[model samples]
Each structure stands twice: as C-alpha cells, then as structure tokens.
Target: MDFLNPNYKVRNLLVLNAAGFSCISLVVFLLATQPFYLSDVIGVPPEKVGSAIGTLGAVDELVAVIVAPLLGTLNDRINGWAWNHSRFPSGSRILELVSFSVLALSLLGYGQFATKLFPDLWFWRAIFAVGVSGCMSIVTVMLHEVNNSDFRWSHMAFWRTQFKNHGERLLDGNGELDTDNGGNNELPTVEDDVFRIEEGPTQQTNKKHGSLAALLGVSTGLGAVFSVLFFLTLPVRLSSWYPDLSSKESLQLSYTLLGYFSAVCGVVVVVFAYDCVKQRRLSGHTPDLELPDTTYFELLKQGLDASRNNLRIQLAYVAAFVSRSTAVATAVFIPLMVYKFYYNSGLCGAEDLQNSLKVRSDLPLKTSCYDGYIFLAILTGVAQTVALVSSPIWGILVDSKKLGSRATLAVASAFGMLGTFGLCLVGRGDVYDPRTATCFILVSLLGLSQIGTIIASMSIVSSVGQTVERTEHRVIGSISGLYSLCGGVGILVITIIGGRWSDHWVFGPFLLLGTFNAALAAVATRRG
Candidate 1:
C-alpha cells in the first residue's frame, strides 16, 4: 500500500505495468497449453486440434498486423496531445480503465458462453483471437503513455540548462534566468541550470520517454505472476472437473475462461487506475518534463524513414524473434506427436499405453514422452529467460565496440541450432527405457541452445538499432508485432504439417523444423 503512494509513483507504475504483462503472459500460456487439453481431455482428434490451433495462429497474425499500426498511430496522437497540453485533458487514465474493463468483460463472456455458443473449435478460436487482439492494443497504448511521461522529465532537464546559460546573460541587473523581470522576479535556481539544451522537439521529448520505458520494462517483468497463476489453474480444470467433455469442448471452455478472466482484469485496471500529472506554476521556464508535439503522421514517417535506413537491424530483430517462435512451436508440437502416434500406436510398453489411454479418457495425459517434452518446455523457458537477460548485457558490450554483432549472433545461433539438433536426436532415437535421466539431459541441452540463439539475436538487434539516430523507441511495438507475425506463420506451417506427419513418422517433421531454424539462424548470424 505504501508503494502505491504518489511519492512512489514510479514503483506503483511498475506494479500496474507488470499486471498488464501478466495478463498477456496468461493468454500466451493458455494458447500453448489448451490445444493439448483439447486432444487429450475432451477427445478432439490430434489433427483436428492442431488444425484449429493453426487457424487461430493465422487469424492472430492477420489481426495483429492490421491492428498494431493503427494502435501505434493512436498512441502517437495521444502522446502529441499530452505533450502540447502538459496533461491528459481527455483523461488518459479514464481510457485505460475503459479498455481494461472491456477486456475483462470480453473474457468473462468467453468463459460463460463456451458451453453454449462457441462449441465449435474455429468459432472459439476466432472469438478468442479477437479478444486478445483488443486487450493487447490497449496494453500497448498504456505502455506508451508510461514511457512518454519519463521522457518528458528528461527533456525538461535539458531545456532548463540551455535557458540558464543564454537567457541569464540578457537579464539587466538581476541574476535571473529569464531576461524579463516581469511581475515575478524569481531567478532560475541552480537545478534549472543543469538540464538545458534546445534542439529538435523529438530530442526534448526523449528524456522523459526513456524513464517511462524503463519503468514499463521493470513492471511488466514483475507482474507476470498473475499469468503464471492463470496457467496453473488450467491443468486442474482439464484434469478434474470436465473429464467427460470432448477435447475440443474442453479446450474451448478453457480458453474462454482464461479470456474472460483477462478481460475482466483489464476492465478493473482501466476503471481503477489513474495517471496524475502534477501542476506547476508557469515562469516562462520550459515545463521540466514534456513530450514532443510531433503529429501521428510525422512520427509514422519518421519511424518508416528510420527503419528503411537501418534495414539490417530490423531484419536481425525479425530473424531472432522468428527463431525463438519456431523453437517454441516445435516444442509444443512434439508432445502432441508422441500422444497421437507413439503412445497409442504400439510404440511403448502395452501396460504404459493402456494407462495412457485411461488417463486420456478422463483428462489430457502426457504420453511416456510427455515428461520429456514438458521437461524440454521448462528448460526452454528457463534458457530463453536467461538468454533474454543476457542479451542486454551483451548489447552493452557491443555498444562499447568490445564485441562484434556478427560474432555474438553467430555464437548464439550456433548454440540454439545445436540444441535443436539434440532434440532431433532424442526424438529419432529409442531411448525410452530410462526416460527420466535421458529426458532431463536432453531438455536441458535444448534449453541451453535456445538461450544462446535468443540472446545473440537480441544483442545484434539492440546494437544495430542504437547505432542509428532518430529511430529511438519509435515503432518498436509495430516492429515487434511484425517479428511475432513471422513466428506465427512458422508455427501455423509446422503445426499443420507436423500434426498429419506424426501419424506416419513422428520424429521426421521435428528434425526438418530444427534444420530450418538452424539455417535461418546461420543466415541471421551472417547478416548481423
């Protein structure tokens, strides 16, 4: 509660930002886990579930592409207003509350309607995707606001310094900062002399924007706990409560419930949260922290120009995100393959198969290979987290010119590719007898490999983006969406092919995916 005070506004902002991120994470986790529950618990066929999920991915990609730019434009417009007015006159906080409320209601509807209307897999997917898209758009805007506030402060500091040096000299007898000894003869304080420097409006705006961005990052990371809680609830629901439902129905219900919760949470956020801007007396001194007044069109043009100028950096970001997505999609699909082809198709011991089938009847049960696959997923999460963390660390090194971007990218890609190969070997081989130890080792190695690739890709992009001027923090979300879109395409392709192919050759498609990822990594490394 103490942390929620205005004096600790930055910390409170972090908490709110993290809460939003947690919601996003929950959505992602549900997306990953629900397909399996559909096939295993509710009795949907593996191929059907895979196809349904694939379609959902395609929809997500389309929606994200369409909505992201629009959202970015909207954010730019809002920011422009905030800067010009020095406050959110239209009530930015109110908008945030409304958006979150809408999100929560949508999720609640999804959960309540699952058993009644969205019985079909595709319908459920379409609705879910739309809900997620809307929620994400609002979240993006909130993040942008948070960032702009901080940049405003820094810009104010810069202007203060410039005013002191130049404006002070013109003051007649008084050592005042302002030349005009108007009604109030308040001289510029020492603090006012430290931050002045006039240039383009964009430069002035960035000082505050940077702090806000940092706060957003920190808050989002911490608030991911709610998402974890949401995910934890899924296994219980699918396993215990609706054991008799078809896999498709169960998965649909699960996702609907998750969405409903998210939407409800979003609504709460929008309604309750407020962004309070402190009022200051005007002394002809620049507002200590203010954003730029660049129009949406100008910002859009600027972002486009910067992207075009730094094509290599943009490409690297795309490649890295794609590789990470590919790895995750492949990890998700492997367990499905095991359940559909190996578990029931007489690949394992008869007793084990019988038990698996019984478990499948009641709930989604992991095959003998389930443990291995999950182990791999856990490892991947860990590795990726580590890799993501290391990326910034390495980015700092690259920025200092102590390391080459190409070299960093290559090493990371090589490790990730090697991990992919390792997973392929495990799938290709018949090492099922001593499953526990073998799975642990393989999953760990795979995770390690993924980390390497992820970190390297991130480092390269960060380094390259920093080298370019006028591109700082612009279109970052849109660019991120594009990168995510590529991965979605990959996931759709692999899920479609892998689902059918698993019936014949369980390990073949995984190997092919690994190979493809490896090649992409190699090319990215070279390009970086």
Candidate 2:
C-alpha cells in the first residue's frame, strides 16, 4: 500500500512506527516502575519518595533538553551525507540502535549495585536520559520526513505531467480515457487551475495525513498500555511463580527481564532500519535531490523562523510541552501516589519498611506490596486503555474542516483541564474507598485528553513540517529537536515543583497539569 512518502514503502513506515512502540514501551516502563524502586527497594520514606523521584526526573529532563537540539541538527547532517554518499543505514537508525542498547544496559545496572554504591545511580540515569533523547529526537525526524508540503512530492508529480493531454483524455471512473467531453480536447481553464490550488490540499494528501496520524496515535497508546500493564504486573507474576523470592526480589527480577527484552528489540532495529531512506521517485527524475545543497546554517535558520513566525507551529510546540509531561510524568506520579497510599496505610511492606526504619514492625504484614503493584498496574492500564480507544477521536477532529486542527486542540485541552483539575477534588487514592472509582473516571478522562493533545499537535506539526520542507529538504530535525526541548522544559517544571507539593498535597502534580491545560486551552482558542 502507498503511504505519504513515495521513496519509503509501507513496510518501512511500519518499521518506523514499531520503533516508536519499542522506545515508548521502554521509557514508560522506566517511569512507571521508578517509584516502586524508590519507595520499596531503596526504602525511601513515603514523604520523601516524591522528592527523590522528582529530583531524578529533573536531571533526566535537564540532560534531554540540552542534547535534543544538538542531536536534532546533527541527525539532518548525517542524513544529508548519507543521501549523497552511501546506501548504509542513516544516522537516525544508528542513533536508535545505540539508544536502545544504552537504555537496556542502564536498566541492567540499576539493581545490581549494592546499597553502598547507590549514589552512583545518578550517573546511570543521566546515561538513560541520553538514550531516551536520542530515540525521541530520531523518531521526531522520521515523522517529519514522512510528509513533504502536504503531499507535494506526489501531488506535484501529478501536476507536472502533460497537462494538455491529461485534459484532452480525462480518465473515467474505471481508469479509461473518457470521450464524454464531446471530442473537445481543450486545455484546463484558468478557473480550473485556481480551484485546484485554492481548494486546500488534495484528497489523496488528506487521506494519508489523517491515516498516518491515526496510525501513530494508536501505536503510542498501545505501547503505553503494553508497557504499563505488562511490566507493572511482572513483580506479582514473578512472586507467584517463584515463592522463595521476596517481593523486593521479584521487582528486581522484573527489571532485569525488561532489560533483556529491550536488548532483543535493539537487534530488531538493526535488521529492519538499515536502509530505509531511498531516492525520491518524483517527476520520473531525481532533480529534487540534485538541487543546491541544504547547508546546516540554512536548515537551522528555517527551523527558528518557523517557530518564530508561525502561530500553529508555536501552539504545536506548546502542546508537545504539556502533552509529553502529561504522558510520562503522570505515569510516574499516579503510580507513585497509589504506592504511597499502600505504604502509609500498612497495606504492604512490613519488613521492607522496617529495614529502612520507615515504621516499627507492628501490623502483622497485612498484605503483600505486590498488591500495590497490581493496583498501580490497573490504574495505569485503565488510563492507557482509554487513550487507545480515544486515539481516533482526535484524528477525526483534526481532519475535519469545521473543527480543524486548532479547534481540536482547544476542545481537547478543555477535557485535559477538566480531568487534571478533577483529580484535585478526589481524595488521595485508596483502593477500598468508594471515592477510588472517581479516580478511575478522572484518569479515563485524562486518557482521552492525553491522546487528543498528541494527535492534534502531531498532525499540525507534520503539515507544517511538510510546508517547511518544500523550501528546504531538511528542516524537520531542528523543529523536532525544538519540540523535544519544550517537552523537556515541561517535565522539568512539573517534576521539580510537583514533587515538593506532593509532600503537602497528594494531588499537586494534577493541579499543575490542570493549569498547563487551562493555559493551553485559552491560547489555542484565542488564535482560532
């Protein structure tokens, strides 16, 4: 089947989307499980768990924001060189491979360190951040490369055909030349040309644009669900399978298994993504690639200019900032909240708590901490399931002329605002309380909002990136780099401040999320 780019086949696109799944699954698994590590394995106090997770994340996003821009431009340079030089796998693929290996190695090292060597954990996290940034930045560029001026590469190729004969021998619905024009072989009128130009993009372009958006949305949502559900449940599953191992031991075992799975996926990337970028097949010639070289300076300038001049691009970046923080940060914080409830209420961890001097061994081991893992898994599972179900909703909304891209974000941001603010009104999560159901409902709402923000922002960016690519072949790396940078800023702000606030109020991170979405809603609508 044909996709957006003629050079790359549908299989390559599938491979690219699979890489997204692989990277996101690993990253989400890390975020989902870290709180358990801090609260249980390391025996951090309940109040301090939030701060420790936050500080670690602050460092993660800090390194990410710094490296994203540099790697963004560097990716384009590597692609440019590869385009002109060799047929080997491009830099982005290599980047993805290296990233996956590094992330896997980081996970493998996490639990192996003795308690005395725990301070060295910071160094590994920084390494993990570099791997994550590389994966994200490269994926951003691939998404950008999938389109060019909203199907200009394909549409222009059609328009560049023999216009006069095309008009004279207009095809019927069955692809045969029609004689229905009463044998008149006149060229298309100026009015016809104007209509084609002014009627927005071609229907073919629209179809591919919406299709790709839907595909990626579902891919990401499914990846998150798979990671959260599967990895979060591993501890309990392992405990049941290995009765001799303690819950802490089960958790470490799960982490090690994830590292092995990630390494296997890295091997898959090398096999499939070795030579994805092909020479363009436009106008039966290679004039597009034969044009003047796109200097790094010009490419970088185009990215800055797009951000400075275009309101949609700016909104897309803002949406990325808020939406990414919403996506991954909440994965950390929500499970962290649930785990905290279990720890405080004596539902789990009598011996583990005492080992760290959290509490005296009083309540006789009322329940296993793996139960907390189960609940954490369930809550996140619900959120991502909702995201997967709602992924298509935003794609349809963005594709609609009546609602358009901007209006979709405006409406979706309202849902995000409602969901995040709604969390503030709910009590700290208790598995037994009737109010716990409300937490699920709010999480579902946020799930809907989460997928919306991503689809809307990505659809807009892809279209805008296409427009920019028309003037210059490779401006997307810098734009996507900037996109990651903004997201890093969002994570940095939410993690640092929300971590401190959680000590005082359990719902502090949700409150911050509500504010971000509220501001996004206002700006998105104001421009409309």
Candidate 3:
C-alpha cells in the first residue's frame, strides 16, 4: 500500500502504473466530453464539431508518431550514457512528469480559449494530445523494462503453475495427480507446460517480469475509476463552483481543474516513481555496451522490422489499433449520439431554463438538464465501474492460463461487436423508453469489451517487447515506442473518418465499431 517504500516493489509498481494511466484517462475523458461543449455551447454544428475534434486528435497522433520513437530512443541513450550522472537513471520518469505538465497546461489553455481569456488556437489543443501520447509512450516503456526482471517472473510462474495445475485437475475430474495409472480421462486438450520444462525466450524474459495481468488490472482499474468519477460529477461541480458563470465558462473551469489535478499527480510521479535501471544496477546487472550511435529513424526501423516479422506482434498491433479506435470513437461520439436521439430538446422554455441551470445540459444557457446527457454519463460510469471490477479477473486469466492474447482478444472483440451493433439498433429505435433500457445494457457491454481489449493487447505487447529484447537485443523502450506508434496510427485512421461518418449518420460510428470489432476478431484468431 505504501508505494514510496522501495522495498515494496510490487506496491510501487502498482501505484506508479495507476498514476500514469490516470493522466491518460483524464485527458481522454475531457476529449470525449468536449464535443458536447462545442456543439451545445459554442453553437458549432454536429458535423463540424466531430470533424474539428477528430482533427485535434489527428494532429496529436501525427506528433506522437514522431515523438514516441525519438523520446524512446533518447531514453535508451540517456540510460546508457547518463546512468551515473542523472538523478533518475531511467530518464523516462522525468519525461513522464514533463509530459503530464504539458498535458495539464494544454487543457488549461483550451479552457482559457473557450472562456475568452485567450485567442482561439488549434495549436494549444494539439499540445494536449502530444503530451498524452508522450506520457503513454514513456510509461509503457518503463513498464516493460521494470516488469522484465527475475523477481517478477517468479511471481508470474508461481501463479501460472498453480492456475494451470488446478485447471488440469478440474478438467480431469480428479484431485490427485496420476503416477503409474493413466491420467484421469478428460476432453482432448493441448497443454503447454513449457514454462516448467524449457528455458525458452519467453520463460527467460519473464524471469524479469512480474504478474503482468495483475499490474495491468490495477493500473487500468484506477484509471477507469478516476475517469468515471471525474466525468460523472463534472457538471454538478462546475455549476457549484461558479454560480454566475456562463455554461462555457463553467465547463472550461472544470477542464482547467482537470489539468491542475493531472499536473499535481505528475509532480508526485517525478519525485517518487521508481528507477528501474538504478535498481538493476544495485542488483549487479550492469550493461557493458555504450549508447547506440544509431539514428532515431534507424532504431524505429528495427522496431518496425521486428513487428513485421513477428506474427503475434503484428496481430497484437492491429488488434490494438482497432480496439483503441472503438474506445476513442465511443468517448467522442456517444454523448453526441445521446443528444441527438434521446434528449427532450423541445423543452426549451423559461421553466426549462431554470431547470437546466440547476441540472445543466450540454448546450449553453440551457438550464434544462438533458436527460440523455445524464443517462449517457451514468451509462459511461457504470461501464467504467464494471471495467474496474472485472480488470483483475481478466488480468488473472491472461497471466495464469494459456489463454494467450489471441483468445483473449477474440473474446473481447465479440463483446465489442455485439455491444456496438446493439447500440446501433438502440439508436435507431422509435421508442425512447425501451431504447433507454437497451442502451444501458449495450454501453455496459462496450465497457467490458474495452477493458478486455486493453488487458489482452497490453499483455501481447509486453510479451513481444520482452521477446524482442532477448532475441533481437533491441532496447525495450524502442520496441514499446513502436507499440504505441501503431496505436497512434489506429487513432488517426478511425477519428479522421469516423468524425465525418458520424456527422452523416447518427449511428454511423457505432456501425463502424461493430464492423471493426468483427474484423479484429477475425485477425486476432491468428496465433498471438
């Protein structure tokens, strides 16, 4: 529980991971809600709103593609060259703090612009995306390196063995192991007890890694909880904080607060986050090689080559691309969809204005709180709550069983497709009452799928990164950077097209989600 205790590495890791992911969730939550503000408060049309928001994200991704690799490679060099000189030998920790601050300021800048305290500029918002991507890149690399250690591997092996052995017994309908007698009769199954028998690259690499599922679950759960709470109470808090403020100003103030919180959290991480490289040095694992002279592009090329050749890596990347696109689209479009379909927009009167002032709607000066917006917030919160509850379970399955990323991703995709398709149907419904009930169920399912996709894809990337480190002798930072780079590409591809698509059809993004998830399922069926 005491993450500052250096002796408690697991606790430290759990806390650090959670804090890092929290920043990401906050940014994403803000982005998702911004569409409502743009359309309702700023008087932007739905089409333009989606397009503009998508463009903002696209700008971030474009920058991410450039920055992630460069920063990752730079970290490797810093670790090699400045290990003795730097305060935090890893360098990523400092970068993470800086990125978080950048993200925070960017959010504040957006708020300022919206509140007419600053000039309207796309550049400021784009900085937010860049900060997010950079933070993600650094945190991911740190996770890979810190996780790939001998102590962690032992933890994973112990749990995996216990789970696998117990599962085998359960399948055989017996409690005891077979000796001279034949094994208990069970369904035909292929079992890989390779971790027990062979010192393959996976086992070797895992020696440095801990229970990845557990780490991932705890981190993602924290993020989910934070996002849900922050967003759910945002309107109420904003309204309470500044009673006389206009709706735009109120919302902008809320975002500014988000930035402040994120920035403070980032400062904490910079001060207390563990230094994995220094820890390795203390453990007598000193690197003999000097910093690589390779250019950033060349290092990136190596990462790309490894991913291209590794089937599991390629599939993981693609699945992440699809899954993340779905998530981003959901965040940006779902509230807008609710506004279009479920809200009682016709109730725009003096009484409604007074009601809205009390409850708050997405639109400016609308005192009538749209039932749809509240419902969407609740739906989103419920889904995130489910994810927080289920993350640990999914994490255990991924780490302890032989389910692998492929099976996990396939299952997640099934849920994603079903939920998205259901949402599409719900959106098209003629009756609001029935649709409301169904919307809750579909959105909840989507949330579960979101967690599943995250855990599976993350596990795959971590495993692949370790493999590349061992077999290719490449820096895990560079490899992890590549994983993030691929994800950035996914965001770009979806947001650019999806924004336009949503403008045309209210259910277009949902349909697209269903189709993409279906494709993800197909591709993820490959060995991963």
**Backbone clashes in model 2, listed as residue pairs:** 149-466
* lDDT of candidate 2 over 1-528, digit per residue (tens): 122243333344566678788778878887887777765567776768788888888888899899887777666666666666545456667777887888788777665652322465566777788888878777766665564422232323334444554454456778776543321123343322322333343443553454466668888778888887777677777777777776667777777887787778777776565242443322122434423256777667777887788788899899988887787545877877777777677778567667776655653232367677777778888888888888777778888879877888888788888788888776654432312778888888888887888888877777753432354335667777888888889888998898788777767888998889988888888843
Give the winner by TM-score.
2
Badly placed stretches (over 4 Å) of model 3 are 1-8, 84-88, 114-121, 150-211, 289-295, 342-344, 347-373, 429-435, 465-474
Write candidate 3's Cα lDDT for 212-323 as tens digits: 6446655765675567566645755676666666656666677778778878878877766666555544434435432335555666677768777878777767776776
Cα TM-score of candidate 2: 0.81
TM-score of 1: 0.61
TM-score of 3: 0.79
For 259-364, candidate 1 gives per-residue lDDT tens digits of 5556556555643343422211122322323234656666666555655677555655555444545554434554444344444445534356667556444443
What's the distance in Å from true for residue 445, model 3?
A: 1.9
For all the candidates, what are their Cα RMSDs to the real structure? 9.6, 9.2, 11.4
TM-score of each: 0.61, 0.81, 0.79
Error of 2 at 92 (Å): 2.8
